[model samples]
Structure formats: structure tokens, C-alpha cells
Target: MPSRTRTHNHQLSDPFAAVLQPPPDETPAALQARVEQEQEQKRVSDQIDDELRKERTERKKRSRREVKVLLLGQSESGKSTVLKNFRLKYAPMQWKAELRSWRAVIQLNLIQNVLTLLDLMQDRLAQPDGPRPGSSGGPSSYSPPSYGRTSMDSTISEITLASSRSTLNVVLTQKHRLLNMRLSPLREVETDLRRRLGAVDPEFTFANGEDGAMNGVPGERRKSAREFGVRGWIGALGFPTSGAARNSDEPMPVDKATEILATLRDEIISLWEDSEIRELLRAKCLRIEDRPGFFLSDTARIANRTYVPSDNDVVRARLRTLGVQEWRITLEHNESFGSEWVIYDVGGSRSMRHAWLPYFDAVNAIIFLAPISCFDERLAEDPSVNRLEDTLLLWKAIVSSKVLGKTTLIVFLNKCDLLKRKLQSGIQVNKHMLSFGTRENEVGVVVKYLKDKFKDILRSDASQPRTTYLYATSVTDTKATAATLNIVRDGIIREHLKHAEFV
Candidate 1:
């Protein structure tokens, strides 16, 4: 009984002895093969572990080492223009690839302007209180659209309002669907072009809303008026096999863009130059030249079958922002600063300003653009407030923000050229801004005064402890802007390096 008890105790202590037992010896060849198989398995396992560790290291480095910049400004203040300049300087290949898309946007702008003129013509004709041609009353609502021309050609002028009305009616009757109230014909083409360029319609927000809440649910994409233009052409036929492979059998995407623009060019010009249309625009004080792609002046050339948009033409094209967009590019000329830069551009409208908050934490630097030329203009979204005043208020909020204490603040006093021209044209600064106590309206004086005002605002927001670099820039001039940006890039890199040493 004592012996049996001893055996049971030993068994309890030796629970893993079976797993530890060695196998019986094998033949020499079999042992060698087994050893080889074990060695191969170990090698593959180690390789997989090494790969996983390498990927983790790369991810951590990317998160910690990337340089980020933010572009901030009000709508139409030239933020996108600055972004484009960066592309032209650093990413020429990508820039060229996207240039073809701008032709469609330019064409869309021109077509919309003509449509506005046409709508005005139709509205005037339908006005119950307005005098008809040759019908006696007080002064008629027949003021001609001012192209700065003294008169229309006698041959066209002789076509009186009544006759011109008939001519327009005949044209409209034949193209009733195209001339409909929805402007579907043009919109369909516009939608297709926008889609190819990966554009979705932007949300509308209340003009003064601080949160930038959308009229609809946030991030919900809405359909524009119509969507059946050039896309239909592609579906009914077929897309080129490849955008890079250009031949008779497979024209490039750029060629397709050229064809669309050329097809619409003459039709847009004809409507724009119509005697009645011009007169209506004049009466309404609507100047299409002030708009983007006033292609009327160069219709013959732009309409040529061979024409493609130049880089400058693409730069001049305007499209409003909808939300936040981020662009990442590798540094080519300025490799000392790190290999990559990520830039964030947000919509500058009051409502869209809310979208800027989430990015404030991670941004290394901020480029704030305030168009000094906006002193005389009003906000397009909110007419009650002067644009310059709003810009100043915005600047105060940004520089004073406790959240952005570490962010290097660069203020671009943009559109200096436009300010100079507006001042030269006798637009008095004091007249628009009563804050100026009868100061001279010269460009140099006004610019200095404006800069001081902005500086004063920055000073009042001193709790945040920041340095402000002010640059007088016209972002449209690529050479000058590029020079300024080089200085900015270098400054930012130096500051980042300094900060890194402390961390």
C-alpha cells in the first residue's frame, strides 16, 4: 500500500513527462530530412515576423514625422490659387494631368453667364408694366447691355426690338428643350464634366451660421439641376481605351475635353453677343467680363477644333470650395525639410469655417490669406457685412485662438494688384471704410494702413503667444508667389526643427 501511494504521488508530479519525452532514433536520411523541414519552417516564421515589425516601424514614423500645413481664408480670397501654385512648382505632372478638366469648368462658367443674360431678356419681354418696342410710355426698360461699344452694327441694330424678339422666339421654338427654364441642356453637360473631374455639388449653409450646418444632412450628396450631357455621349458611344494612349481609334481624355468646349463655344458666343442679350446685361449691370472664362472675346480661337487649354488659362479658372480637401506631395527642390508635405484647404465661407476646427490640433503651420482688395466689396453670401471687416474679425479669431498657439501664422495680404487697380480707378478707401479719418486713398498708403490694422488685431490676441509673418502677395502671379512660398517653406522647416529639438 505504501509503494502504490508513492507511485500515485510521482504521476501527479510528472504530468508533462509525456510531452518532454524524446522520439525514438530514426534512420540517418530520415533524420536529415526532418531537420531540413524544421529549419525551413523557422526561417519563414522569422521572415514574417521581420516584415510585420518593419511595417509597424514605418507607420509610426509616418505618423510622427510628417509635416502638415493648412491654408485658411475666406471664399474667393485666392486660397485655391495658392494651392495651385504649389502644384505647378512641385507637381507639374499631376498639374498637367488635371489641366484638361479645367476646360470644362471654364466652359460651364461661360455658358451660365450667357444663360443669365438670356433669362434677363426673357424676363424683360414678359414684364407686364414694361413698354414694348415703339409703344409710347415712360422710358422703356430697353437699356442696352454695355459691351463698352457705342453702338451695334447698323445691320443688326436695324433689327428692332420687335423683330429681334421674333428672331429669338424662332430660335427658341426650334430649341425649346435646350432653352427651357431648367437650362437642362447645359446643366447635363456640366454635371458630366464635373463628375469626370471627381466634383460633387457643395452644400449650402446659412450665411451667418457659425457651425456651418448644411441645409441638408452633412455629407449627403445632392443632385444638381440635371445630369445628362457629355456623360451621355460616352455611354451612347464609348470612352477612349486609355487617356494616355491617343490615336484616331482612342482619343485622349484631353481631346474629349477639347471637343466638348469647341462644340459649345460658338453657341455661347452667339447668345452673348446677341443685340437683345447685350442690352439686357447692360440694363442689369451684369458684366460677364468680370466672371471667369469670359470666352466671348476669344470665341473664334477657343472654338477651334485643335484648341486645348493652356496652363495659365487653367490657373485662371474659378470653382468654389465645398468642404475640406487634403493634398500630399513629396518635396522636390526643398528635400532638406523632409520628403513630404500635406496641405489642408477648407472652405472659407462663414459656415465652412466650422470645418477648420478639427484640423487645428495637428497642423504645424497656417497660411491665412486676407484679400486687402476686399475693402470695398461685400460678402457674396452675406451682403450686410463688409468683406474686409469680416476678414479682420476672422483673423482676430485665428491669431487669438489658444488652440493654435504653436502654429506658425503667415498672413498673405493677397490681391495687392487688384487693390492697386481699384485705388487707381478712383475708388476711395475712406468712402467704404469710415474708420479711415480722411486718409489719402493711394495704394501704398492704403496698403500700409491696412497692414497696420491687421497687425493691431494680431496684437490684441496676444494671449496665444505667436509670431505673425505678413506677406503682400498676388497669388495669381506664379513667379512672385513661388518666391514668397520658398521663404515660407524654409521658415516653417527651421521652426519645426527648433521645436523638434525641445521635444
Candidate 2:
């Protein structure tokens, strides 16, 4: 037993002994040389270890100095728009570099508007009792579908037929058919552009009840079925990063789309501007102008070959965020507030909310955008819930989160412009929100009411006491938003410094 134990111990030590052993034929001079060589190696190893330690400490200091902001809101609530504003302000060079790429997206937006109009026109024409010229009625009684267990087709059909009884008397002639045929090539262009934009994923599939679609569908069908979103903006825009190959001469997908749009520009304008078509749109209660990424009104300018998207155009551009996007901007002029700012933009759709949990930790501040204009609107994914209701619920969940207890909460009652427009158009706020009852329907009253509601939620639901900033904003108005952002930037910096013990 003692011999066996000795053998086991010897086996373990054999490898160590081999490593410690020196050359059997070593002379004193050779031994001295080996010792010196080992000593030099040890010195190098120690130097590397010290450098690594210093690097780690520096990384920690940099992280501590970095200011992280998160943009949160429901889909189309202007989260991306706010991010663009930040980039345009603090990261102008980077924003300018990516400006040309937005041409494709703008073109795509215009094409989509055209296509939607064409589809509605075709659907109208197919009806046996289509509205005749000069037909008029009371205001549209159409209410978009509430959340119910129904197939997508049925929901779409209901929406299509909702305004059927109130449609403007517009007749489609053979000219419309000819124009649609002329624009058929646009379908191909759209498919090509979507492929180039990385909007379609072949491997992924949407299950039923996901994204509020009732039927399971392959990701390939998402081209038309789902709101457009690229997997990553860097890859989608073909923006070159470090070590990425750049092919300056390579043909871009936008070029083809642009060429096609330029040729069909007149026809598209004619289709869009036709008095009959305008009446038809009004009759069907299809407010295409209200949709995100709308560019029909700018068709002529956008379809031009030399078109460049203005700063306002980029801010208004709607690119659905699929996951979380991190944008880092080094403050060029403001050194006292920290040199580095990291902004996280997340997908706010109900289906995408799961992706947000991982980011809640370590966020310094959150800019939550609630589009007050959407009080009457329903979530596209879940039509049953009012947009305002959904926003409040989301705000409650965010404030009540224990992980985000220390984070500063900032609320931008966004899209005040749209809210004003809607109010002026005679949409009753109380009709959509019972809680908004008996209040004067003025914009100021509506905004104040909504702001107070948000404040109430923050006060009641927050896990800990914290300061909350509320601003009424029209985020699309670059000038006004810039001013608001300045105030917001200072507030964020102040909070950051306080948290960092620099105050």
C-alpha cells in the first residue's frame, strides 16, 4: 500500500520534475547562460502582467467616465428620431457619412406609399358596388380593429371595408390599370432593395400571436407582412468599419431603385395627385400621411437622381429597430460633462420588449418618448390596446423595475405637433380616453393632461424616489428638438456627475 501511494505521488510529480530538470551535460557557463535567459523571460512576463494591470485599471476608469443613455418608447414613438437628433448634434461627421445611404430608405418609403395606394385602389375597383362619382356621406365611422382572436386577413379585410360605406365617389378607369402595370417593376425593385437592406431573414419564422399576426409565417414573407427592419444598420447601410473591405465601384441597390423611381416619377405623381384618388383615400379613412416613413408628398424631390436627404429628412425617416442598437458619440465641445456618451436605442414593440431587459442594468438615464398624438391610435401589433394605455403600462413597468431603480427617468411627450393637428381636426380626446373626459380639447390642455398622467405613473410606480423630467416635444422639428435636447443633455450630465460623485 505504501509503495502504491508512492507510485501515485511520483506520477503526479514526474511532469513537474521534467520541467524543473536542467540539461544533464550542462557546464557552469551554460548553466549561468540558462539562468540569465530565464531571468530575462521572467522580466518580460512581469512587464506584460504590469501592463495588463494598468490597461484594466484604465478601462475601469473609462467605463466610469462614460455616460450611457437609453431611448425607450413604443414602436414609432420617435425613439429613433431622438437618437438621430443626438447623432446630428454630437456626431455630425458620422451622421453626414451615412446621409447618402438614406436615399434608398427614402425611395423605399415613397415606393411603399405608392404601392399601398395602388392596392387600395385595386381593392376599391374590385368591389361590385364601388363608390360612384359625387357620392358623399357623413364622417367615416371606421374604428380600427381592437385586439381580438382573428386571422390577419380578416383584420385587414375589416379595415378595408370599414370605410367602404363612407368612401368618396371615385371611379377607376383603364388608365389606373395601365398605370399600375407601368409601376409593376417597382415590386421587383422593392424586393431587391429589401434583400440589400437585410430586411428579410430566411431562417427565422414568426409564430402565431407574435407581432399580432394570427398565422405562422416564414421570415421570407416578412417583406410585406412585417414592418421593415434591418438586422443591423451597419451591415444594412453597407457602412465600412475598421478591417471591412470597401468596394467604391460596386453597384449599389439604391442606384437601381433610384433609376426606376426616376423613370416612373411622373406616373407616381399623377397617381398620387389624381383628384379621384385623393377622394378615394379620404373616403377609405386611410391617412397614409400619418404613417411613419411617409414620403408621398416629396415624391418629385426624392425621385430625383441627385437627391440628398436633408437633416430633417433623416430625422423623419422611419427605420424599424429590430433589436438593440448602441451608438457612441464623443462629446466634441462639452468636456466637463464627460467626453464619451453611449446611447442605446431599443425596439419598443411588444414582441421586442424582451430584448430590452439585458440593457436595463447600468443605464445612466432613460429617455422615454410617448407620442401623445397616438391617444386614439391602437398598437399595430395588438390592435385591442389604445396607444396611450400601452405607453402608460410600459412606463409603469419601467419605473417599477428594481434593476432600474437608480436610473434617471426622462419623459418626452413627443409628437405634440401631430397631437395638435388631430385636435384641430375635431378628434375628441375623451372619445378615445375616458380619463380625458370633460377637459377642453385644446393642445395645451391635452399635453398637460398626458404629462400629468405620466408623472402620476412615475410617482406611484417607481421602485425608489428619483427626479423625473418631462418635456412636451415635437421631435421631428429639428430646431425645437435641438433646444429640448440641450436641456436634456445638461440634465443627463448633471445626474451623471452626481451619480459619479463629481458634483
Choose the strongest candidate by lDDT. Answer: 2
TM-score of every candidate = 0.70, 0.81
RMSD of 1: 11.3
Clashes of 2: 1
Give the clash total for candidate 1. 5
Clashes in model 2: which pairs? 147-384
Model 2 lDDT per residue over 126-234, tens place:
7676655555442233333434322311211111112233435777888888888998898888888887787743223446764322111111123234358887787
lDDT of 1 by residue, 1-503 (tens): 12335655665689775353223455668667867887999999999999999999976676555678899988878887888888788766656655544556666555555455554545554546554444443223222221111121111111111112211211122333244443435555655656665554434334443322111111111111111122122222232323332232333354554565566665666666566556544433344454334456666666556555566666666666656778777665556445578988778877788889999988889999999887755454554455677787788788878888888889999989888876876667765565565778887787788788878877776556456899999887888988998899878877777776334
lDDT of each: 0.61, 0.74
Q: Which stretches of candidate 1 lie over 4 Å from their true place?
A: 1-28, 127-188, 191-202, 205-264, 270-287, 292-298, 501-503
Give one clash count per candidate, in the order shown.
Answer: 5, 1
Model 2, C-alpha of 202: deviation from truth (Å): 14
Q: Candidate 1, which ten residues in sequence have the lowest lDDT sum?
A: 213-222
